[model samples]
Target: MDSISQLPDALLLGVLSLLPAKDVVATMILSKRWQFLWMFVPKLIYDDNYQNIEFERLSRFVYRSLLLHEAPVIETLHFIIRPKSNVVDIGVWTRTAVKRCVRELIIEMDCSSSSTAPVMLPRSLYSGCSILVKLKLKKVVLVDVTSPFSFPSLKELSLKSVKYPDEEFVQSLLSNCPVLESLVVKQCPNDNATIFTVKNSSLKSLVLENQDLRYNDIGAGYVIDAPSLEKFKIRDLHEDRFCVIENEMPNIVEADIDVAYGHPGKILSSITSVKHLTLCITSSKDAYPVGLAFCSLVYLEIWTLDTEWSNDLNLLMCVLRDSPNLRALKLEQLDCDGDRSCWMEPSSAPECVIWSLETLELVDYEGAEEEKKVIAFILRNANCLKKATISTESTDPNKRLEMLKELELFPRRSPNCQLAFYYSP
Candidate 1:
């Protein structure tokens, strides 16, 4: 026998641990010794994105594999099953994994069909899986818990396309995770719950992404009250009524907010302590709250949907004025359509614009009169500026050259500043 085939049982099992559950089971054909070596592997991953195999055969194979595995404590159990999979088999498989003391469980189920009801996890998962440290479920329905439950060891929990029984169940689920530090929820319009309030003190990172705003004035909202949160991100693709940040996060280091239409103040006010911030706002008029100061901000990126750039010009000026210690600035125009007739300079330049700003980046630069004026204004005032990069959407070589010439003629306040241009074809 070869040296590899003659390896020790423990080493052989270690090799098999990296293979998918299907491939591990196929090792039965290699040799008698290799047949049961895979049974001792600690991690089992099953993915049913195959084309030739029939669903009935796949189901039987999964059940047989689970029954034959000889591992004492399963470290990881992952299943990526299609929506057409049998719910009863999934439940049985999950129960078996829980019985074997699974430490990490991930289930990604496709629910695009919408014809099948969301799969209900076994109750044993909540009450019995004491060793679980990470749990991620997609397109699963979480039923209301009648009895008390807690995941004492869970540290990471992600629910995407998940349907909750009610608002109370979600609260109960989060409250039970004593050590959970990272939580992610990507909810859709059909998720049934219009409002989700996360109020965990132990959470450090939170992400809330809501898609497909049903109506222009849908009364959807989120309430976050995590005091220890350090990284926060929220994206509402369409219009929502409002978002409430009940507690001011003192330890927030990073925040990324994108709201198509809503009260922008609720988001800006919550991240005053953040060092890195990205704001993507789309409103008919400027909506940023006044007197907000980003005392800790060092990097700032702004994306506006105003075609004229005048709708949010005042808000932009306020942000520049508030971030006195900012070192980098990035501006991108989302919907560049109208003329530059609406552009007007602020009464006075911000302190950061004159002294602290070092790097400036502009995207979707169309070489309009207002864009030229803004570029000139920054180059003429920013004494500490080191580099400025401008990327335009125009593909024509002649237009790019013309825009570059126009920008090069603008006077520079800092002799050390370098200019760079990029053209998107």
Candidate 2:
């Protein structure tokens, strides 16, 4: 490979830093240290095929290769602009030669018509304690914040399909990012969510996807008030004004929600300190909201379908009187009716006969016998129950597993529960 332009300029600026800075400035006549190591390669990846070229010859070769780079700390400046109109400012002279050693700034623009022009962010990046951790933006719009900004070692921040309709400029750009932890906002605007009221105790992983959030209107405050938040994910909720118990963000342990209308229900103020909860109920609920509680939920997954529920046994007896630290429970596509009476019976069978349940899964169960006596009254009252699995798709499978082995008044596993039967022909 000695023929590879006689190699070395740190191996041809690491293969022209993966090409395209106009093909690494045409590999600088392939000599003279690749014409000064392709303007001091520190990562400035740009794409969108550099937009049909010729934006004044691509702004005079990225402003003469950032003025023949004398090295000013450029370590990652990815751009993928796709603007045809909006009065083309052409990213204001290559972001003013990225003055302060730009430490990671990615902007992925895509404008289709509509022009007012005044949006050219990348100025008040990071000062004082600047380490510019990591920032990802899509369809970005942060019209320069007046400049007392800070990035005191910013952390992971991802905002996709953005649109910020001033909430004091999104809380003055998140109150100057004072040690912002992992925060991801997908599909924003209409107050482009990230509304943390004062208390920023160093946020810890919060994500709001496709949000229409309206929080901290005081009294019913908080879009986020991280007391060291712990992994929270809210996915695509068109509207119902994005409520998570009034934007409390309760010291989450881990939660993934998708809600639009659980009504005066999603008022989940205190999650009893979550422990893995995944709820993907795409609206159309008949009942799953009786002031739902998680009482320290411990692994509970419900995808929903019991005929889209009308009360799925009063939402499974409100998770047995509010999850007494539940221990693994998965119910999917449930909708039984062989006279299991569909809950509400004597207060949901004394809240599913008291719990602290341990493993109870029923997927697509339909061989109703009162849903097999509510899975044998939750294995004869979940006294630290161990197992109960019933799978059904159906196929003369021992007539629904021998009609659950001839009912036998419940006893498939008692010395601490354990009964398995899967059917899928």
| Top candidate when judged by TM-score against the true structure | 1
Instruction: Estimate TM-scores for all models.
Output: 0.92, 0.29
- Model 1 deviation from native, Cα RMSD in Å: 2.4
For each candidate, how many residue pairs have backbone atoms clashing (under 3 Å)? 0, 2
Residue-wise lDDT of candidate 1 within 1-425, one digit each (tens)?
46789888878878887888888888888888776877878888887765546668888988888888888888888988788878888888888888787889999886556665677777767887788998999988776768888899998999998888888888888999989999999885567677788989999999988865553335667888999999999888776556888988999999998887556787888889999998888773657887889989999998887655776666677889999999899988745565634768887789999989999999989887767777898899999999999999897889999999998999999999999998865
- Model 1 regions lying over 4 Å from their true place: 1-18, 111-116, 215-218, 284-286, 339-341
Query: Per-residue CA lDDT of candidate 2, range 255-292, in tens?
Result: 77655544414534444477887666555345355555
